[model samples]
Target: MSDPILKARGLNKRYGKVTAIDNCDFDLMPGEILAVIGDNGAGKSTLIKALSGAVQPDSGKIWLDGQEVAFASPNDARANGIETVYQTLAMSPALSITDNMFMGRELRKPGLMGKLFRTLDKKAMEDFAREKLAELGLMTIQNINQAVETLSGGQRQGVAVARAAAFGSRVIILDEPTAALGVKESRRVLELILDVRSRGIPIILISHNMPHVFEVADRIHIHRLGKRAAVIRPSDFSMSDAVAIMTGAMEPPASMAA
Candidate 1:
């Protein structure tokens, strides 16, 4: 196995003595789907936020592809090839699909038009968005110019994932990608996740759905009491075993220690 593409050591975060994350460590290897699972208030979101630059850790070390980095903002993470699609999706409903895809990083036209006047190259952005959507088998969206508000829940999720896939070069972090979808829609999003992994980008999937975690995760990182309890292969441990470890009902076996 290769070294971790994303790595963290001794991460700690707190608010008024309420520890959100405590001495936590994390690793995301190349081209793998790692699921971070825990009960509510388990500090999963804080760990992810720290990684994605949404929240700063009080103390920790982070490395991307073996080079240490400190991300002060989400854009800092994005510039370092880390993109996060929050559970909220963080999109403008009234914007066109193309616009939403290139929301922060808009493409500018060539020469003085782009350099001086700062004219956005709509055609280039549209073409690139269309190509990425098609590459991801998301052409079912039909119109690249359609307003995001007019799309279905699943379709909206698709666009968000597509945007991440389009620009996220090293790692893509998904926060509960299927939390709001119907059964069929959830299935579609799951397939989309596999499709993204197929393209050689590793993903950090944060989800609470046990069946979904067991279904797609190559390895499950169980969070308990503000830190990682264990890392286990889904095949090596049953869902009930994971729940037991997560809730402090059972200890993780030696073979599955993180």
Candidate 2:
């Protein structure tokens, strides 16, 4: 394919004597969703943390848009146009949608010789936030002032996704996005993921739900015991083949696992 938007080569992470991730190589292209599947302790989280700059890798190289880069912290990664949405949602239950959208990056008016600042531009920010939600087909939310806790699970996820997308990031990393939702809610979140992909943003979706992964992912990468077992395109494998690779019951197709 074309040059990947994000690329990791020989990504390795360790803790004392334990190797959490080993020689993981992967690439994410624009408008594509890549799913990472494996058993518990398979180092999927570690690999994501490394990529998101939540944890430093012992040895590896990361390239973004063809330029090699090293991130010292999660903020650094964000500055590099990589946003990560963890499973916790990381949103304050009492905060309004607009408040949460511009949580850390609020828009303020200058005042008092530019030393002091006026209150936030609530209307402008809210309008912009609403527009973004609408673009994602979340326009059903009438009040941007509603508490996040009051929203449904899928709606909250949509807000989280909107927050990431509004930040103008080139890539978004989702960690177990549908792990705790009901079937309907899970499907809604999956649809949101596909919507995000259609907007030309590359996504690295880490999910264990086989059906969900198959439904939305363009490519699948299986991690086995801290190593990259395979990277297969959806068209090249069936759901059963993916399950086998994920469970370690069978090896990946020769061309893919190589």
Candidate 3:
């Protein structure tokens, strides 16, 4: 079997007295959508935090592309080609679409204007942003320079996903991507997710929406009590079965245990 593109083992995290994650393990394969489902406070956030470099595990190891690595912050993860589109969307409402896409990692001009004066290459950044959005069919956005706040919720989500896809060379982790959208918008975001995966980058989707998970995920990772309970394919298990495994109503077979 091909090794997992992203993997975690023996991950543990605690908040002084409370354990957020305990001996947690995870795996994400190349070019596939891995849905992580868990109840509130089930340590799913903590696990994702560790992987994305938002939180450090008390003890554990993470690997990407077959090499072990550690991250001190989200920037570190981004440096290693791991990008996360948080639930909040994390964009500056007043900024233009191109600005939001290249927020922290803006491109600089080539000559002294860039090197000595630290000038930004706005055209380069805009061109790249426009290309990425067009590639993802988000050109429905009338203006590339429009403020993010002017767009609808689904359009904002599309911009965020497009940003991740543009720079997330290895993997993209999305948290509750469709939580706040109506059915139509949610469907668009789902299609965007599949489009990103179609480009060969694996995605780790953290969501509570079962139908969405069943629709896009190739394999579902069931998390419970701060650990992965089982990994099963939507093709082989019903949505109800995934819920049962997540809530401890049913025990997955030994083969499915993570």
Candidate 4:
């Protein structure tokens, strides 16, 4: 019910003659989890890319914290407290957890000369990484110096999620976060997502898992053929209704369909 932390109005994206996304509107409220569900080629990725600043929308306005803004790049989005965890996991397998955590934004200590002054503060970074991991309920990780490749699929996801949270984002967008994980791993990731929501940060969860969406999302937004089909509160819709809307078997709710 509070003002949204991120809002996309009339979001449109096109690839040559293919209209991937058209006139989509989305809003993520503070500490709320909004799930996006659609079949393959539903323009879910395109919408997320546009929202995260990975790609510019052909026509749309992005309002962050109630003010319209444009992001030139993903870094620009990050600087504005918007972070995204793509499906690919975007982490180096051989890199240590601490290194991966502070990959782009490393902490440095002052030294003798201006050129020689840039030395990484390993201890501080490791300590902070441990705290972050703990906050994400990944306290089982005993070593921040271990290579990320050594972690399990769920653990690796936890690392990626921790990195996103550590960046101090007000809104976090996760794309198919539990897509490839096993049942247990998927549940773990879902728990992590709920944990993130409880921390007062809004989340845009892009998933095809209807059951999972019903379980974790506060509201469901169905995208059908690049347009928003419907936005339904979990309490008002059953899984069958959600699937029906997603697959075009039923008409969208009036406000969203308009």
Candidate 5:
């Protein structure tokens, strides 16, 4: 599409005798949801880890916005405007929604209090947090001050996604966001994914649910045998065909032959 906002080539990673990723190549177009799917132990996680800077690929090249770059850690990736939402959600159960939203990147009071005492700007953070949640259709909660533990699984997921949408200026990566959610909650999370994409930010999703992948992903990147086997549009590949390709039951489309 548009000169891929993120691109990788010949990515490889190994742990002792195990090869986690092998010669993997990937691309994410701007403002599109690119879903990466594979069976267990198929190196899907490793591929994402490498892309998100959670793990380093032994040999490869990464280009962000067409400039060759390297990430030494997850923080480095975040600094480069790439935010990842792990399945864990990474929220403090006892913290307020506003607190969780501004956990590491909290704002401070203006001028003296902010400079001398370094006090948190709770009002500002809460106001912005509410606005973000509202934009994502997650404003049903009666209190933003309530502990995150009191929120439903879907609500918690929404908060995490809201945080990402608020700050992930370049790209947002989600790993199995709906795996632990119920049918209705999962559906809500899917809608949130689309909402996030509509904001003009590209997304990279890693999911195992075939139905979810088919429903939300504009394009699918099939991972097999520790590498990318094919990249196909959802319109060109059925859910059954995608699964077959992941499990080696069917050959990839000839146009995508690598």
Candidate 6:
């Protein structure tokens, strides 16, 4: 693969006696879905948090496009074109899709109204939001002004992903995006993942569902004991094999025998 768009080396984080991450190394190739899998407490979430700037690692170096950098907060990561959509989606339930998309980074009115009164550019925000949602095939939304709380689980997921795709210029991190939905809804989200990847944005997916991981991930990053155990291609490892590796019931393939 070409130089990874995102790379990390020697990442470590600890919470008192518990070590959340242990000298981990990671990479995300451009335009590939890299699924991260592990058993409970395997530090998968911690690794993501560190990458997303939700938690500061004790020690590590991160490189985006081969330039070393540090993220002080989630906003810092977002500014650098790394967006994360957690399980909760972090959206205001009562707000419209347009409002949710521009919650913090809202556009303002032009001239004196923007300077003195500080009014928002609602039309511009709505137009952009509608375009993004439509790109994701979310035309079921009859009105962009409809409150997010009125949407179904799958539609809600679509909205969250659309918001990410609209902003995430480099990479998008999805954490168990299908955890709570039914099979059909889950499929919808999986399709959405592929749709996002098709647009040339690399995705780092953290999921426990082996089937979902297998279906969408181009490569699998098996994490165990707070560190990366192996990085394998989907074609090289079966679902059961990936599960065994993640649970430490089996060792990595012979290629990792070194």
- Model 5 clash pairs are none
Which candidate model has the greater lDDT, 4 or 5? 5
lDDT by residue for model 2 (1-258), tens? 799999899988889898899888878887789998889999999999998899999898999999998989988998888988889988999999999988877887466623475677788899999999998889999999999999998899989988888774789999999997899989888888988888889899999898888888988888898888989887778878877887789977777874
Give the RMSD in angstroms, all C-alphas superposed, for model 3: 0.8
lDDT string for model 4 (90-177, tens) is 8899999999888888888656532487778888899999999999889899999999999998899999899888785698899899
Off by over 4 Å in 5: none
Query: lDDT: which is higher, 3 or 4?
Result: 3
Off by over 4 Å in 4: 111-117, 255-258
In candidate 5, where is summed lDDT lowest over 10 consecutive residues? Answer: 249-258
- The count of residue-pair clashes in candidate 5 stands at 0
Model 1, runs deviating above 4 Å: none
Error of 6 at 88 (Å): 0.6
- Pairs of residues clashing in candidate 3: none
In model 4, the worst 10-residue window by lDDT is 109-118
RMSD of each: 0.8, 1.7, 0.8, 1.5, 1.1, 1.1
Clash count per candidate:
0, 0, 0, 0, 0, 0
Q: What tens digits encode model 5's per-residue C-alpha lDDT throughout 1-258?
A: 369999999999999999998898999999999999999999999989888899989999999999988899988888899998989999999999999998888999999999999999999999999999999999897599999999999999999999988989999999999999999999999999999998899999999898999898999999999988899899987899999999999998889745
Q: What TM-score, to 2 decimals, does candidate 2 have?
A: 0.94
TM-score of each: 0.98, 0.94, 0.98, 0.95, 0.97, 0.97
Q: What is the C-alpha lDDT profile of model 3 across 114-199, one tens digit per residue?
A: 99999999999989999999999998886889999999999999999999999999999999999999999999999999999999
TM-score of 4: 0.95
Ranking by lDDT: 3, 1, 5, 6, 4, 2
